[model samples]
Structure formats: structure tokens, C-alpha cells
Target: MKLKTLILAITFLATFNLFAQNTYVFLGSYNRDKTAEAIQVYQLDTLKGKLSKVTSAKDIINPSYLTLSPNGKYLYACTDTKTPNAGSVSSFEFNPENKSLTFLNKQSSGGENPVYVSIHKSGKWLVNANYTEGSVSVHPLLENGKIDSLAQNFQYMDGSTNKERQTRSHVHSAVFSPQNDYLFLPDLGVDKIRCYQFDENKKQPLVETKSPFTKTDLEAGPRHFTFHPNQKFGYCIEEMAGAISVYQYENGTLNKIQRIYTHPDKIKSGFESSDIHISPDGKFLYATNRGKENNIAIFSIDENGLLKNIGYQSTLGKHPRIFAIDESGKFLIATNVLTGNVVVFKRDQKTGMLKKTENKVKMENVSCVQIKRI
Candidate 1:
């Protein structure tokens, strides 16, 4: 009887180990005006937070922005033609068994230069930011996970104070609040962060108490903003000034608390900011500086949610447009748009610093990185 019990215990342990080891990473790519280039898919191992290529050079248009469904069974990407005139988004059915993606369908984004895409928390709405048209649009997701025609669209009229880049309102990113109660849209052209209350029951969004939303410093040109996991603080990456502004947020209103330059003192040069992300632990914040300076600015968040400069790390490539921390917070992947390389970095959890890793993924004009678990 003792021998039989030992064998059954061993079998149960093996099954438990197998069930605990399931996870993956999905990468989205842009074609960069070339044919025969397809969206690349990679399998991310959860145990080590390492990425391995699963699908090579398959044909999918510009997969600019990628977001997974709340249920983790689907992936969606914004496919732009790379021209000012053509833009669309596509949905894919993700297969965990094969580590592959199957295209579902495509829908027009209702404006030119659709650069960013996001899904509502309720999984009922998909929002797009039309850069050239300076507008934001909402699409209803059908029961099958495909996007329908535009349900609502809004265009900004007041242009930015800066003429070169902000001659018109450029809607850059739209994101839903963690509670699914409000939607925040950051516009580069008008230098405004618009807030809207989303009614999941009615399938519509209403402007919040602030309505047209809050404005940053004139001509600050907010490109991206990220809310702290606690939802008490927010950070905005300003493209025009290459600075980050910290804000105290409560009940859908943002009160500016501090602003600081991403670049170190005496390094006076032109640089554009791309993305901002808060660490999973809510203890650190990171913002990417593209253009002349290709580095990431790091900051530490105090108990009060104020930001203090930690340091900066070179991405080891050009145009670090987007980057993401692995689900485990063990690794970070920075996409270099100009150099066409994705540089991997290991995270120092204690000091919130990133050290270059030996693993690097090479591709052409890579725009963004998204990771998931199977």
C-alpha cells in the first residue's frame, strides 16, 4: 500500500508542474512600407521571461498597436498603410496550442493616420486615435470579437500653439480607466487630455465633469499618459517639450503637481518623447526619449505619488518608440524604430534600473512590444 501511494503522489506532482508552467508573449510588428513582410509572433516563456520566435515573416499589414482581449483569447492590432491616407485595424484569433494567430477581419478606423488602438474594459468598445485627422473614434465590438463600423467620432478644432508639429489636433492615444468608468484621450495637436465617462450599459461615452478635458502647459503636446496602478497619480509624456508632468488624480480629475525634464542638465538637444509606463509595483516610472537622445528616463515614485529622477539608460538603438515590461517584471523589451532592433533589458527590482540583456531580437522598423501568457 505504501508503494502504490508513492507512485500516485509522483503523478499528481507532475500534473501540477505542467499546469503551473503555462505562459506566452505576443509581438506585433509594422511592415515599414515593404511587401512580403508579415506580422511576427513570438512565444514568451513565463518561467524565465524569455522570448522565442514562433512565426516568421508572414504577411500582415502594419500592425502598429496590439491589445489582447480581457479573456486573453484574442489579439487586435491597428494596421495602417503607412501613408497619410490609409489606415485600418484587424482582429486575430490567438491559438495557444500552436503559438500562432489567425486573422479574423479588418475594419476602417474612420479617419486618416490611425496610429493607436485600445479596447474598452467591458470588451464592448474599441477606440482609435487618428493622428492626421486630429480625431478620436469608437467602434463597437461584435459578439464574435470583430469590430463594427464607427459608433461615435469626435474631431478637435483648436490647433496647438506650436506650428511645426501641432498645426492640427493629433489624437495620439486613448485608454480606458482601470475601473472602466472613464476614458482618457491624449491629443498631441491640441495639447489636451480629454476625459469621458463610459456607460457600458448604454454602449456610449459621455464627457466627464471636465468635459473637453484638461490642458497641459500650452504647446506641451502630450503624446502619452499612464496612470499609476493605484489610480491616485498619472504621468504625461510631453513630446514638444520633452518633459514629464506628474499629476494627482481623483474622481476623474487631474491636478498638476510637478513637471520635470527627461533629459539631464547640460544635455541641451532636441529629443522627442514617445511612451510612458509605470512599473507593476507602482514604485517606479519610465519614459522613452526618442530623436537625438535615444534613452529611457527613470523616476522613482514616493509614497505621495510624486516623481523623483532616478536615472536614464540608453536603449542601445534609435527611435525607441515603445517598450513593455514582461508580465513577471523580470525583463523589458525596447523597440527601436530607426535601427529596426528590439533590445532586451533585465530589470533590477531593488533600484529600478535596466541592464542590457544578451538576448536581442532584430527586425525592421519595429514599433511596439506586447507580452502575454498562454
Candidate 2:
């Protein structure tokens, strides 16, 4: 009887341990022509929703955007540069035991100034957005989590209404549909979201009937977008207008449903928007506003996929370039580019609001933040 009781107690403790394990945050930096910038890592307590630093920030070149594999074992970042067109994607193996990263390999992004990276659902392909060269490329990923080679490349030729902002097409982000059957490329320069049918076996993207993608006003300058878990709705953050657009997505096609301002209707400030994200629970959407006004605008999504503005929270730092929510949906980390600080926010699941936490990590010209669990 004593041995049986001891075994039952051990089982209970093991179950609790699994439940208590939380996610870790990984931050990407821009470096901004400096020598090199570091990618910061932190562990977030799941039960308490608290953040603590893990590895000392390690320096790397301009890593603007980052993505983790489905298994959460590998991390990929886009290093943006102009000299020698040094645009590449670097891979790292994540060591969850120590909350550290081990460098794996690097691959050319196939264009200049690659700003964003997205991995396919199957973990077999990577899609990159080339900001300067105005193109998108798909690359095959090896089993070892390294980029094998470029599989497909598509260039944009058209320009948008805004001359200064859109002198030429600038592909800002490339994302795959939840089903992984289509790829969506948002071009800030052309104000359009280009769609391509993806072939996993062929490792290539072919234009679909819903091809050439959908346009977002002539010069709205869509920067980043996110889809709801239901896969029926999507949201886009417009950079030039500081607006959020809601769309209805069906059968590989998109139709604009609604558009709303990111800022208060009365506040007149010259601010540009940067990133947009949807909560894992599909209850809220958050967007970052930069420039003279720095804050994150929050919105509640209705059952019908409409967005109703909740409020805006000051990022507590400058140039909130990009931010991300942890896998558990317990914490949000906002990266301030100019001031070089990453601030943590406790997400109120009930209210769908963000409260600034006491923990803030300092770094240089931080561009993106990603979080994963062990």
C-alpha cells in the first residue's frame, strides 16, 4: 500500500509539471548598420504570466523577421542588408532545456533586403519577402532544419499611388494559408496581396484563378496581415493610413469586409503602422503604431469577423516595430526599434486588453519578437 501511494503521488506531480511548463520568447534585432545585433531570449512563466531573461543576448546581423518550426525545434530569421545584397535567412536549433539557440546554417534569400520569413505548415518550405528588390521566393527546407535551395521566385513590376512610399513594388510579407494550399504575398509598394497556388510535391507556386491577388485601396500600403484560426477571416494593417482592414477569405479568395482606423477617431497624429497579429484564441487583434505616436491598438473580433476598436496602449518605448504573443496566449512582447527596448505585457484574456508588465529587456534596434514553449 505504501509503494502504490508513492507511485500515485509521483504521477500527480508529473502531470502538474507538464501543465506548468511555459513558453520562451525570442527577439530579432535590426542592428541598423551597426556591427551586429543580438537575438534576445526569455522564459515566460505560464501560471504567473511573468517573463525572465534566459540567454545573454547574442549578436547577429540585421534579423528583421523570425519564424519557428512547427515542432518548435528550429528558428529562422531574415537578415536584411544592401551591401553585396547580403540578404539571407539564418537557421538556429532551439535548445529548450537551457532556453538557448545553436546556429545551424544560412541561405541566400534570392533578393535584396529580405524582410520577412514564413515556414509552410508541412515544415518542408520557406517563403521570404524581399523588401527592396520587390520579390518573393520559396525555398525548400531539409529534414535537418536547414534551407536546401530556392524553389520558386516571383518579382513585382507594378507600382502604387504613393510615389515616395511606392516608387516600386516592395513585398513586405509572404504567408501561407492555414490549409497550406495557397501563398499570400503583401506588397506595400503596390498595395496588393498576391496569391499563388502552392505545390508541395513540386516545391513551386503557380498562379491561381484568384491570381495576382487582391488590392487594398490604391495606396493603402498594407504592411502585415494575420488570419483567424477559423481560416474564414483575415486582418491587414495599413502602414501609410494607420488603418486596419478586415476581409472575408473563402476558397483561396479575399473580399474586403470592413476598414477602421487604428488610432482614436479624434486624435490627429502622423503615425505609421507596422505589425498586426491575431490572438491564438481568435478573440482579439493587435497592431503596432510607430513614428511620432507609438502604441498598440487593440480590437475585439466579433463572431461575424468584424473588428471593433477597444483602445490603444502605449508601447512604453519608441518605434514599436514588431511584437508577438506567446503560444500559450498569456504574454505579449513589444520591441521598440529606436530606443532598443523590449517590453512585456500581460494579456487579460477576459477583457482582451494588455497591461504593461514590470519586466522589460534592453537591446539595440530590435525588429521582431517570437515566443515558443519547451
Candidate 3:
């Protein structure tokens, strides 16, 4: 009787371990001119950092960026359309069991060339940024996780000192604060991080915050924003300047703390900073630099929200448009657009270093990657 009881306990533990090892990684691509699917699903072996193709969603034109719902049951993408100066957003119900997607609905993104999409923590709002037309839109989320019509949209008219790149306001990323009380829109063309008050209780959910906006350096085009888990600090990567600005965040206000260069030695040209992400443990930060340098810069965050440059990891491909660390922080995947491949790297938890793995998957014109455990 004792031996039989022990055998039953061991079998249950093995089953649970197997179930926990499976993770879903969704890759979004610039499929406008490529034959690859718009969204491809892969089953990631977290322990070994291996990816196996699961399924895909095709015919989506330029799903450049994607965001999973808070519950991981729905997925949203910025459908960067072929229409001149206009684009839209799409919502899909994600089936984790089968690793498939069901198209729910689509709506105009309220501007042109939508580049980024982020869902609110409360699952009540979906916000997107349009790069070409310099606008951001906020759409409401329905009970079924479908996106409703645009609730509020704002256009920025300011431009920075760079004549070529900053000719018009170009909203690059729309990210919410950790507390979900504020929305930060990093405008690459205007060199300003626009802050807005977000109230999900209201029909028009987004409004200008008390301070309105904060300015970056004259030509420092802020492209993306990420908040520390503590909610006390924020970071924005400058696209044109190739630098990261650290800010002290409190109640919709951003106080610039420090601005550091992403490269070892700055180049006169060819610096287009792409994405920024913080580790789940809130101990390290990573930012990508495109153009001449195809690498991800790593930094260690101190207790005072200051950053110390650690090292850089080669992305192994050209134009690493977007990269994401898994929920467990054990794996990092970089989607290279020019090389048409996604490279997975194993992360060192203690030192926050990334070691390249042998796993590489080919997806034509891949632009974005998002991973979650389900």
C-alpha cells in the first residue's frame, strides 16, 4: 500500500512538471511584402530554450507589433495597412490549448501607419500609436475581449530639431504606467514623452495630464518607454540620439534623472534605437540599437533607479526590430527583420547576461515577438 501511494504521488508531480514546461511565443511580422504569415505561434521549451512551430494566422498585412491580453486569452496587433497614410488594429481570441487564433474584430487606428499596440492592465482599453501621421488612439475593450471603436484620439504637431527624421510628430510607442493611472506616448519626431491621464471609468478615457508633456533633448527622439516594477522610475530610449533617459515617475509626472548613451562610442549617423524592456525581476534593462549597430545593450539598475552599463549582445541578424524575454526571464528572443530570423538566447539570472543558443527559426520579415506561459 505504501509503495502504491508513493508511485501515485510521483506520477502527479511528473504531469504537473510537463504541463508547466510548455510556453507560447507569438511572432508578428511585416508581411506586406513577404510570404510569411502575419502571426506565427511556437511552443517554447523553457528549460532548453527551444521553439517548435505550433500554428499561424495569415493574411494580416503588416502586423508589426502585438500585445497579449492580461489573461493571455486574447491577442491584439497593429494592422499597419497598405493604405496610404492610414492603418487599423485587429483583435483575436487566442486558444492556448490548440495554439490557434480566432479573428474577433478590426477598427481604424485613428491615424496612419500604426506601429505599436498595448492593452491596459484592467483589460478595459487598447491603445495604439501611429508613426507616420503622428497620432495615438485609445479604444475600449468589450466584455468578449474584442476591441470597440476608438474612444479618444490625439494628434501631436510638434517637431524636433532633426529636419529629416523630425519633420512631423511621430508617435512610436504607447505604454501604460505600472499603476495604470497614466499613459506615456514616446514621440520620435517631436522629442517629447507625452503624458496623459487614463481613467477607464470614463467614456473618453484619456486626457492631458496636469503637466501635459516633458521634452527630451533637441534631437533626441524618444521612441519607446518602459517602467520599473517598483513604479518609481521610467526609462525611454531615444531613437535618433542613441541614448536612454532615466526618469523618476510619480503621479503622472516624469522627472529626468539621467541620460546615458547606448553605444560604447557614438557614431555621427546610423543610430536608430528600436525597443526597450526591463527584466521581470526589475534588476536589469535591455535596449536595442538598429542601423549600423545590431546589438542589445544591457544595464544593471541600482536601488535609486540609476543604470550601470554592463555589456552588449550581438543579435545575430540585421534590423532586430523587436525582442522580448519570456515571463520567467529565462529566455530572450530577438526578431530580426532584415535577416528574416528569430534568435533565442539563454539568460543568466544572477548576472543578467545573455548567452546565444543554437535555436534559430526563420520567419520572413519578422518584426515583433511576444511570449507568454499558458
Candidate 4:
């Protein structure tokens, strides 16, 4: 009887490995006209690399960035962007059963050009980074998937060395640390990453950490950040420098470890690093280059969390702004903002390479892409 039970368990494990999980892809775009399908949802056929349109939410102006709640029930996006003093974060209720996103409500983003949004792992806290005005907005999340009014707006006062770009604070992204006990705001205008301790129980959850911020190289212009799966290392992609800064992450502190260029040629002219993400298995890191390069730089992570440049994959589209790897690490989808093309690529798990597949779709101003397994 023991032999039979052992064989049954082995058989079950093999069956599970043969089937991948159901994946849903979420897309956000720039809709300055407030029409033409601003946000969309698609179901990914993992085996074939096919993307089927599930739903589209329209009339939300400039839903350029998006984040999902921890529970996967709430979807939030930056709306009314690029307009002075009118930016807002809108919320939607995601119905996985029907693959639909129902519009919920919106709250003021507290500044202009709200470009990025991030939510805490607990699903109780949400934050937005206003780019043009250089501020951070904090909001509370209700149990019913509604976003509460703005609780705090932290504004930056100074800039960095670049006269053309850094004359004023431009907060590009707000991301929570791996442990969710800290929040980090990357200031492109200041060339510094501001840190703050967070306590969800407090009326205002964001407060200055012992180390208030980490200064990046002058004119680095940090845009996006991501943490490793082991929770011991973090990466910040600097737009202006076209490089990534590695850090040793502990508690609320980040100690710089190494800086590496994303491109091999070290070209100076027209390249901006836009987004960064680690594979679900933490074996590889990828960053999108938006300007003239328009490619995704791939790096292999060592045992100690240092990165070694491995290869570069052309996005097969122009202005590759954001790309997301599926939870299975078998598929990667990249969105090109200028060409409005969303291309799907099959990922080689062993070598960390991406090959373009025939599966592709076009949406006007498609700027962000995210994939999650359900």
C-alpha cells in the first residue's frame, strides 16, 4: 500500500508540471483624447503564445500606468495625466470569472503627470508618483476594492546637476520594498531615491526612514526599480545614464553594490532605460530601452546578486516602454508606445533569451503591459 501511495504522488506531480496556469494580461495606454480603448485585458494562451482580447475599458484619459491589488481584485491606473494639477488615480473591479474590469472610481493624484502607481503587498495601501510636479501621493484601500481619498502628498523641493532635465524634481515611480515595510520614490529630477518607513495602521503611513534617501550618480535619472526573488537585492534602472544600479537591500536601507550599463555599445546619443523586472524564478533581469535602441537588455543574476550582461533582444517595435514576463517565465510581452504594437515573445527559461513570436496586437499608444497567472 505504501508503494502504491508513493507512485500516486509522483504521478500527480508530473501531471501538474505538464500544465501551466491560466494567465491574464493587463494593458494600459496613453489616451489623451479619452477614447479608443485606454485599458485592456487579454487571456494568454501559454502553449501557443496567442493573446485573445478579453475586455477593454475606455474613456479614462491617459491611463498610462497600472497596478493591481495583492488580491488581484482591484486594478488601479494613472489617469488625467500630462495635464497640470488634474492627475488622478482611477480604480476598477477586476472580475476574473468574466475577464472584465468594471470602473470603480478615481481620486486626485495630488500633482501633475502621475506616471506610475504601486500598491503595498497587504492590499491596504496604494501610492502614486507624480512626474512633472515631483510628488508622491498615498491612498488607503477599502475592503470592497475602492481607493480612499489622498492621505498624504510628499513633495520634493530640489533638483540635481542636469540643467535641462533636473532643474526641478520629477518623481518617476513609487515602488514598495520587497518586505512592504518601506516605500521608495525614484526622483528623476533630483537623481535620488527617497526612502520612507511605512506603517499601515497609522493615519499617515509614510514617514522618513533613518536613511532618508540614497543619492544616485549625478544625472543618472532613475526611472524604475525591482527586487530579486530572494529579497536580498534590488535594482534601479537609470534613464539618463542608461545603466542599472545594484544594491544590497536590508530593512529600509539600500547599499550600492555595482553599476552596469544596459547596452553593450555604450552609446551616448539617444537611449533611455524605461522599465525593469526580474523573472519569477529570479534567474534573470530585463530592462527596456525606449529611445533609439528600442530593445530589452537581458542579464543573468549570479549567486551573490550581481548581474552579468548576457544578450539583447529587439522589441520588434518602436519605443519599447514596458515589458512583463509571465509568472511561468515562459512568455514575455513588450509594449511599444510610439508604434502602438504589443508583441509577444517566447522566453527560453534555460538561457534567458527571447524570440519573437507571431502573436501580436496593435493598440493606440499602448505603453504598459503586465501579465499575471491566476
Stretches of candidate 2 off by over 4 Å are 1-17, 32-37, 56-59, 82-84, 205-207
Compute the lDDT of residue 53 as modeled in candidate 2: 74
lDDT tens readout by residue for model 4, 1-374: 99999999999998896563467899998877765788999999988899999898987888878888876778999998877568999999988787688999999999998999998888888899999989999999889888899899988879999999999999999888877889988899999999999998898999887799999999999999998999999999999999999999999899999999998675776888999998889999999887778999999999899999999999988998888988788999999989999999999999999999999999888978878776
The numbered model that scores best in TM-score is 4
Which residue pairs overlap in candidate 3's backbone?
none
Q: lDDT order of candidates, best first?
A: 4, 3, 2, 1
Task: Score every model by TM-score.
Answer: 0.91, 0.92, 0.93, 0.94
Model 2 residue 215 lDDT score: 87
| Candidate 4 least-lDDT 10 residues | 14-23
For TM-score, candidate 1 versus 3, the one ahead is 3
Instruction: Output the TM-score of candidate 3.
Output: 0.93
- Tens-digit per-residue lDDT, 55-94, candidate 1: 6434567777778887777787878746568888778887
Q: Which parts of model 1 are misplaced by more than 4 Å?
A: 1-21, 46-49, 56-58, 206-210
Clash totals for all models, in order? 4, 1, 0, 0
Which pairs of residues collide in model 2? 37-60
Pairwise lDDT winner, candidates 2 and 3 = 3
Which rank order by TM-score, best down to worst? 4, 3, 2, 1
lDDT score, candidate 3, position 124 = 85
| Two-way TM-score contest, 2 vs 3, winner | 3
